[model samples]
Target: MQNQSLTIKKEKILTGDRATGQLHLGHFVGSLQQRTALQHQYEQTILVADLQGLTDNGHNPHKVSSNILNVVADYLAVGIDPQKTTICLQSAIPALSELTMYYSNLVSVARLQRNPTVKNEIAGKSFGSSIPTGFLTYPISQAADITAFKATLIPVGDDQLPMIEQTNEIVRKLNYIAQDDILVECRPLLSKVSRLPSSDGKSKMSKSMGNCILLDSSERDISKAVKSMYTDPSHLRVEDPGKVEGNVVFTYLDAFHPDAAYVHELKARYQQGGLGDGTTKKILEECLQEILKPIRERRKTFISDKSQLIEILRSGSQKSQEESNQVLNSVKNAFGLNFFQL
Candidate 1:
């Protein structure tokens, strides 16, 4: 399969994570998997969004700084080949912030307030009316992030569809006012997986939730987590006949396991009675281990060569700056704001 050749048109893609914490299986299946697959087919930039991290983590620069390497480790763990993809630190590109400042003026507080993505995020985080200024305007920053590299495709989960729309709106607004399409629009590349459920059967798998399985978890840790994972509460006995609806085990299998026929058989047995939750959980552990073992091993190697990893970031940032400068220059010229002597 690795040697089989498939041909298609390719477009530049920019996608990344906020370096808020170590990424988990949710992140890997949702975005990293697709990014790794597309790196060879497209011009790609996988950014560690440290500057974007400042939006909510302003008081925790150390938190963001420490996680920068952790997130980079996650990227490598998931097989995002740095040789095929430019891995950049977003804060290292000054022009992105510069462009964000100008783009901020083009958007009004009312317009920003109307952004569905920002609205949902603000409410989800319970910021209500007092949302942080930076967090409120993050979509604009995202637009800057995308436009800075002229990224044409952005891989995001379903909930983030509004973000791509917001970015295209910005692109249209900027081009209309500047009378040139200096900012390229971005389209969403939605994943085939559903939103990964939390181990505790919670609504989301967040770092604070204590429900995530980290990429670096040991085999023993994986076993413990799987054993404790949420399944049908009514499934008290092995013969009770369980329900798979809202079962984290089944949800995970649907997302990660490739053996669809085996999974279907397992689900049928569980629903028809006799199959134990423990048995299902053990199967999940085995399936997850197969996928994560190589990733964890790769992460260990990346962690060992910390300085070399940092050098990779620096080189990638330098390349990013070159591209950002060209885009910024084009944007400035479109707005007639590039005259140095004016």
Candidate 2:
């Protein structure tokens, strides 16, 4: 606990999402709530990673570009105050791109291919023999993002630990080659609830799949999603015993429901018998609606004025430029690339 407090006091946190879609309940549990709570304790920066979003969606660039403001709204809706957290756009940070170019040389194609995260993504995308260079070396760009900000802590999922591991690898290699400590290594802060699966029990809650209950979803949408959630298939009767372990309704309850003792009791009844899926689903639905209604309202208000949203992003990106340029200059000096005074 002392170590956690120490890290919180001293470390700057950098975390964000790809600008492909609006965030969902899964994101709320995994990181957004943590960001709102940590903003005052740490110097936090949220990057709208449009560039990274383009990695797989290059063919549909509009999808990445269109959701930038929506993602920002999701941030604000969840109580990430702009005054407390610096929210920036990745595409606007020139130093990050320059750093990515320089750092790319330090990472080998073989090494990029060896990254477990990248390998898994490649297998999932089925990019076979035609993988984009940008998609494959994404870890290098992420390394640039982390080092450029001198961010010491990154909030991410367990699956992203490999990315964090590879970031430190680049930091160590860069410092070694430069014979100076030009970059700071970052650590991953995994959420207590590491992942929230899809409502249909297919995979991780993803926007592309249309199975996630988005933070801004309408009341009807929430009800429909909850009703469709995957539960114990064999529990055809309310009197039959049900497994709470893989039950999506109970899982959501555990993550979102505030009363742990109450949720525990519900789980016990579910496992023992006499608790129907409808009852569990209704409980989860009500909990989610109560939690998300305010978020939806706030998100609606933020996105109503598009110009204001753009200004917020612009101001934060400018702030990031100043901070990132200092790190970039130190890196260039280490690499002997800073020739002109200007």
Candidate 3:
């Protein structure tokens, strides 16, 4: 028999992004940076969630397909070591789809509708009364993604807590019905930086909104984005005292600037009316450029070799499939659905 003690010591983490666009600074501050830090400590599996992207981009399948490689490049560029982290494509793992199908039966339409994350997203997209079934049921698919790997830790933003709660609910229901511990519940590792707003000072950074500074953004792009960042609207002159509250530039600095004392001083100066928006923006631009320069250089090297990128994803998908298949078989066996136990 396998050593149960050894199994208990292993910590597995599952996290990823929707393959709709290149990741941005918001992603770095929100989860990507955290993933890189935790990769060595846990058995990390990062999914390029093309299937989930299809939930909303079903009509534009090309958009999702085209961005898959770009997303992978961003991951590699941001120091997510392919050697240390298993980066897999979600659609490539058939087990996840199969698991989602079975898990869907365990959840209710009313329960899915009640999920706060889903509701807020649907409303934000203006789907109103006509919500896509796939979009609404993505929480179940996400649950499948988590339980298939038996991941113990899921790194997510605070807004995604409802999805984690819903996944645990399904796990509990399945275990109770099958009278077996076939699936494991996951815990959310909430991001230290909640969410980064867009350069335009919107609530969230969105690619479609054209307000994001991509992980692979050129120095010029970063400068342009920084220059346009929202600051105190009423502070029109250099000598006028500016409001720091709701200023997006200050928010980015607080999240990324390494020098806390310098940032504090800048904030004080801006509040007291000596600092100008241009000078403040220049500081922000320099800070962002310093952070992104290395990542952009690294991304160029990976993007130049498409075949190598493909191989890395293919290898990771194969490994992920093997791991998820074991859990799927156990689940099938628990429910008396394993007809041919190979």
Candidate 4:
């Protein structure tokens, strides 16, 4: 078992995924991969963001609950050792809710509205007029989640940098006004590779879009998903000049394939009118299958016994509560809001 107290030189880290659905390749290369690496170096807190899940899936709490296990399975399957990381379900932690209420007052509606990430998300989801209050205030909730753990480093993709900035701004504002350094400032650990797009190459891979290749998917399913991936539309004939630019096949190769020189050679040949899109897609499919094999096998082993999986989460939630309580007490003292007069 890995040690619980990793040498986190700065402060702890709070990072998690909303339990919307099973995590896919996009999540793997973008965030989860980096998170697993960080666990060895930091006091990592992984939150199953059920409360944030409700922002959009409020009517489907059961779906969210079911997927919570799926998300955990994905995490475990990807090498996130439970013994080294504290994993907590967000709704299970009451201190997060308490912190969110306090932080919300520190931020204004206008500020959230101006957040580029929020704006893009709202537009993407077509929440033009009926955006829920919870969804709108999620940034503040995120601040609570981060501060509750006193996380100094949040690993996220480049697109999520705005949220980190928003959290930091709130941290600075609260500490400045209270004349105390209560909330720790957080920095974004951006991934070198951006998120993978959907199989059709139209947008980012998402559960709702039905374009994800899940970590738990069978080898056949992964092959099928990759086989159907979109490529250059103009490349009709095998010998026709193919464009590697914007081709999903080349994109995946660029992101995942270990042989950078080979991929660059393929791209050069692809642009020169000799390489076939089908051949390129085949290579990508094979490469993806190789990468996903171990993850799929691990997931199968995990699903073979539900009891152990449940125990992992229960234990994780308990451990997380212990740490979060300490932070909450410090926060209460900083604001002179301790209820018991201790």
Candidate 5:
């Protein structure tokens, strides 16, 4: 009998953000933490998706252009080691756009319209009756991002499950048409933590709405945001029994507080009509201040050297460009489009 042993390939993680604004706690809770933890465990890439940022903000290109470095700074502040993870500017990688164009043909307009995530965003953006074609087909572009690097894992939120499904759809179709497994299907690494709602608790945290506490927010800013956090309106008086559900303060406490038992105890006391909102908010403010102070300091240092950030982006983009070019070549050959040896 022959001894048999098998080696498993490490899973590659591809995650990123649209460079619309500075990253915030919503990003911290959703993906940044996971990316940092996974960096040492697997090969990871973070794309500052400037092109995707342009999909909706085509009218004000400056907003997208200006925030690219801010986004990179946030990544550095949050413990994303550039040595372990490749952080690249999306537009610099020409292969991604080319792949997007090729992948677009495999998907349909009707299919893009049906994506629940895109539809919800379109409504939120008030793009009614005039959705930009780029905005509508961004999921295809995301497919290109994943497959271009041959990523096996994509960290996403629950709302983004449809995007992963759509990518795999493209992967299956292209593989079938090419009669080869040229592209790999990727899976979503959903965050275990729940979504972090805005401090106002009226909607999701958004930079445009100023409802988010940015990663680079000052101590005063974090404290102010925490103080204004939505708590139980019914509990007007300290003696009045407070409702924990829909109470943004306790929701954050549950998410970020160091001790679970302590948070649970506080919640019980508040529900039983003793703890005051002021006291609770004060506690949360302290917690947030402690968490954000280090991040702010680190971000400040990263921003001090503009050349360093540019170099980081240039080097990462160069590495990604080479990898993506190889994948794009394979894709073109699949379509019989590599007509010339050159």
Candidate 6:
């Protein structure tokens, strides 16, 4: 119903979650925060990628389905305006899947296997010789997702740079073969903060690992998680000098705390041997609570009105469908796949 224009002068961004679970603090620090700031500056389209989630979650349809609204609520809670950012469900846009099928031919199996992001993920899942076909091909689907919206910017973690490179490769291949600029290329908008380590000091914060602080976590939950967060393992005494690097609590503070000067002072005190782990943890907890309280309250409001949340997603998907149809039609015409075209 909105002005879902197929042509716009402003640059566009397309990004979203996999609808695998509730978003966490890591997501906020890494991408969501950046997205909120960029929405007004760019024509943004945020997607709840249910079909891509199925690459790994195919057997768990209910998990993906249920988490779609949960992800939408998290987006709204973090200030992703439905009026400014088109938040849509991936499965609802049929054009993306069709684009993926065509784009798949533009890339080769060896190239897909060589993608660093894919290799690391497959290694983590330990799929061994039986990696699902969909899991292997999800990057092509991602390429389709970006090109379908003509998105020129993608907010991604450092590890995902290869995915964008792969997308552009397909774009070049398509245009060269068609002898027309039928597909647009996209670049990665890298996150400013490096990956946030898990509270338990793992290199990554993951839902499957059960080490994340959910965006909607209660104050009590936040406190409990922060108290148990990993610190200098060898700092056996309160007066002992502690290492600040790789200290998960300090890392979180650096990522989320608003007062840079204060955090810097805390880090210096922490390394100078007077700051106790409990004291630093308390500061980190307070800072996190201050940031998350508003988000939690906002999430509660959206979650209570499921129909409204669904309607927002439905409307966004309709607008996205209209826009994607334009790109899909162009692709079909370029490839001579549009049998109806004279």
**Candidate whose lDDT is highest:** 5
Per-residue lDDT of candidate 1, residues 1-342 (tens digit): 554444444589999988889998888888888988999889999889998887887877887898888888888888888899999999999999988988888888998888787787777788656667999889889999999999999998888888888888888888997887778888989988737878888777776466788999899888888988899999999998999999999998888889999999999999999999988988899999999899999999998889978988999999999999998887787677989935
Error of 2 at 255 (Å): 0.5
Worst window of 10 by summed lDDT in candidate 4:
2-11
Candidate 4 Cα deviation (angstroms), residue 164: 0.7
Clashes by residue pair, model 6: none
What's model 4's TM-score? 0.94
The residue ranges of model 2 lying beyond 4 angstroms of the native Cα positions read 1-10
- lDDT of every predicted structure (CA atoms): 0.88, 0.92, 0.92, 0.86, 0.93, 0.92
> Residue-wise lDDT of candidate 3 within 226-342, one digit each (tens)?
988899999999999999999999999999999999999999999999999999898989999999999999999998898988999999999999999998887787677998764
Shift of residue 298 alpha carbon in model 3, Å: 1.1
lDDT of 5 by residue, 1-342 (tens): 443422545689999999999999999988999999999888899999999999989999999999999999999999999999999999999999999999999998999999999999999999879989999999999999999999999999999999999999999999998999999999989997648999889998887777899998888888889988899989999999999999999989988889999999999999999899999999999888899999999999999988999999999999999999999998898888999964
Per-residue lDDT over 161-274 for candidate 4, one digit per residue giving the tens place of the 0 to 100 score = 899999999889888867888778999888877678888898988886778888877878977887888888898987788888788888899888999999999998888888
lDDT of 6: 0.92
Query: Candidate 6, residue 74: CA error in Å?
Result: 0.5
Off by over 4 Å in 1: 1-9
Candidate 2: C-alpha lDDT = 0.92
* Clashing residue pairs found in predicted model 4: none
Query: Whose TM-score is higher: candidate 2's or candidate 6's?
Result: 6
Model 1, position 147, has a per-residue lDDT of 92
C-alpha RMSD for every candidate: 3.2, 3.2, 2.5, 2.8, 2.5, 3.0
Q: In model 1, where is the ten-residue run with the lowest total lDDT? A: 1-10
Considering only N, C-alpha and C atoms within 3 Å, which residue pairs clash in candidate 3?
A: none
Clashes of 6: 0
Q: After superposition, how far is residue 150 of candidate 2 from its true place, in Å?
A: 0.4
